[model samples]
Target chain A: MNFDNMRFSKEHEWVEFEKSSEVVTIGITDFAAGELGDIVFVELPEVGREVKNKEPVGAIEAVKTVADLFAPLSGVVKEVNTQLEDNPGLVNQSPYKEGWFLRLQMTDRSELDELMSHDDYSRITGTE
Target chain B: MSEPKKTPLYDVHQSLGGKMVEFAGFLMPVAYGSIIDEHNAVRERVGVFDVSHMGQFVVTGTDAREFVNRMITNDCSKLLPGNLQYTVMCREDGTVVDDLLVYVISEDRIILVVNAANIEKDYEHLTSRKRKNVEVSDVSEEYALVAVQGPRTREVIAACPFFGQVADRLQKLPYYNGITFYHRGAEVLVSRTGYTGELGFEVFVPAELAVALWDQIVVAGEDCGLAVIGLGARDTLRFEAAYCLYGHELDDHTSPLEAGLSWVVKLKKPSFCGAEALRKEKAKGSKRVLIGLAVSGRNIARQGYTVLRDGREVGRVTSGAFAPTLHKSLCMALVDRACSAGDGQFAVWVRDKEVPAKPTSLPFYKSRAK
Candidate 1:
């Protein structure tokens, strides 16, 4: 639940660095999953698919509704969460942990600076 | 945000942390906890739904049956007191306006419950075509409707100290039967029919007493596992049960025959709203039929998903969802006449994704249902 080291978006996405220099992990914000009930399916982008910042790279569907997962930064999709196809409720149970949507091959790592910080995203979503 | 409209049971759902949604202009609880949890509660034990948004109208006086027989497609002349039947209000062209339940409470009085979105429209239609001997009026705002559905509904009612009689009526009553009965001294009309594909009852009571009734029922049934359901679970439960939703399956553009509900229509009648039209359509078989499609891929075929044959668009997906009961991608699609696509020979173009699907029979999870 702590978003201290992350950068967030108004669309309810978060990006964080994976210990390695070029790797980035992406997931939908808690607000998105809560607004959408139990997640039923997630369509992740193919590996090596280049995506622009804020452009949709994948989708998430819940029992009653559906939402788009946007690319937090312009990057090539290094990995997509395949496990979500069978158990999409992971987003509802643990959207931040096991529910991470995709991993990106970051093109411009500095784009993270433009995203809202933890405190800023919390205020924007009004979940503060 | 604008002020969220509240139902008669608004406080009860919110107090239990319900997620609210605007459906047919009313702020209604779509779910209390998890949708699947609430859905399963209805199938296994009992679940209560605040269906006040659905409109109710009263038709009374000397010629109630005559008025209904002329307006709706079903024959009402044979309906005596304490009888109920599922009927459809249709346009002159035989296209369904809205499917509803007609309750003949007495020789001179009857109550008609309609879909929430078609309240104003159905009311206006009834009033404009007023019968000389029958007085028709919309009494939706003055009433609140509640539904207690599932197999163990009777057990839950017995827990209510004042509901001994209600429990008995619900158990002995046959399907499609209704009675203007009493509940804890307050008179109500309980009908033995529901959308959940189970033994259930729909209660119509005074709007002012709605909240008290919901709380009383909840407290009485809590130990028996009666959950408070919202629209979210309602849609899923109905879909899993293969029940047709008005907007999705049957619309102004879709005919009753095409929607596979012609059983409710009586063409034997001398004359009703759409008898002639339906008779002609019957001679010339319907162009399309509503069939169930269970998909294989994760890309769900939603409301407007295109159905493809030979990779070309054939028909459209009317309503689709992640069916909780079957735990698979399921949809209801209207395809070309007598779609010959064998068991596993169909696909849906879901947002540029060609997802694998097959034409499966409805009620995807019949074995587990109540």
Candidate 2:
């Protein structure tokens, strides 16, 4: 829940880097989940698929609408949350923890600098 | 084009954290929290929906019944007072104008409940087709409507203190029937009908008393698991029941017979608005038929998605959703009659990808109301 270490995207995604590794975990923010209503299914990208920053690599299917999951940073998909295959509600229930979408090996760590902090994201979404 | 109108329950929805959206010229709630939760609550227990945005019109005069019978596709002559009929009004060419519920009150009075988006158009259609001895009045602003649905719907209503003696009679009120009583000197009508495939009631109360009525129902259903639903859940519930949404399934270009609403289109009726055109179409046979499609993919086959038979496009999806109750991706589409005959290899174009689909029978979910 600490925003000090998290980087948020204008598209409502959040990214957290590992302590010393180039790998960064990605997921949509709670505000995004709330906006999408009840998530029923999620389409995950295959591991090792190279993704570009701001490019859609996967999709999240809610009860009424579908949203593209955009990559917050350029990287190769290293791991995906397989648990979301059967229980997509986790994205709404725990947007920052277990609902994490995928971990990517960062191609450009500097991309995180361009992302917004929790404060900036809160302001953009008017969640504060 | 102008500022969206707000219903009497607008403030109540805001306080409940409802996600408001502009729909049919009114600012209404799309969901309070989760649509699936609201949908399940209606299927398993009870749920309430604020549908005040829907339009209501009253027809009165000596020739009201006869005028109504000539306007709608259904035989209103068979309906007794206090009966309700799901019917459609069409143009002279057999194209749909709007599908509405006809509330037959008496030989000289009737009520027409129409969809919100089509209020102005329906009013114009009715007035243009108006006959002698009949008068049409738009009373939409005078009433606020709420739908309470589920297996436990009756229990929730019976517990409401304001209902008084009417509660006892409502229990015996058969399906498609309604009862009217005076509440605070204002006429209130409660009908045993709903869009969801469950035992439900649609209450038309005075606009001024709408907030109080909604509050009372919420309090009464506190112990029995009642969720305050919004438009999101309302669509899914009705889609599960295969109810034809006005814009989705029924439109100005589609005939009632092709929409699989032949049962309600009484061609035997001597003369109605579209009776002649419908009779001819029925004899010639409809070229298109509405069919259900079960998508075998994670992605939803959304509206306007192309339906494919082999490699050729056959039809377009009308309405689709990940059915919360069924837990499957399903959609309803109007396809060529040849493609509707038997279950065959079908697919839906979800963007550029072709997802496998199967031609299934209409109504992916069965009705539990009866």
DockQ of 1: 0.72
- Which TM-score does chain B of candidate 1 obtain? 0.93
Tens-place lDDT per residue, model 2, B1-370, is 9999999999999999999999999999999988888999999999999999999999999999898899999999879999999999999999999999999887789999999999999999999999889999999999999999999888899899868779899988999999999998998999999999889999999999999999999999988899999999999999999999999999999999999999899998889999889999999898888989899977898889999988688899999998888888999998888765664688999876899997777777885564
Please, what are the lDDT tens digits per residue for candidate 1 over residues A1-128?
56666788888888877545787889987888888887778888899899998898778887877777788899888888877877888888887889888888889988988989888888887888
> Could you give candidate 1's per-residue lDDT for residues B1-370 as a string of tens digits?
4564566777777888887788887889888878988888888889999999888889998988788888888888898888898888888898988989899999888999899888878988888887588898888888888998887777766776545665776668777888776665667887887888777878888887888878878988888889999898898888877778899988888888888788888888888887888999889988887888888866678887888766766788888888776678899887776554454367898876788777788666563333
C-alpha lDDT of all candidate models, in order: 0.82, 0.91
Listed for every candidate in order, the interface RMSD values in angstroms are 1.2, 1.1
Best by TM-score: 2
* Candidates, DockQ: 0.72, 0.82
Off by over 4 Å in 1: A18-20, B1-5, B183-185, B338-344, B365-370
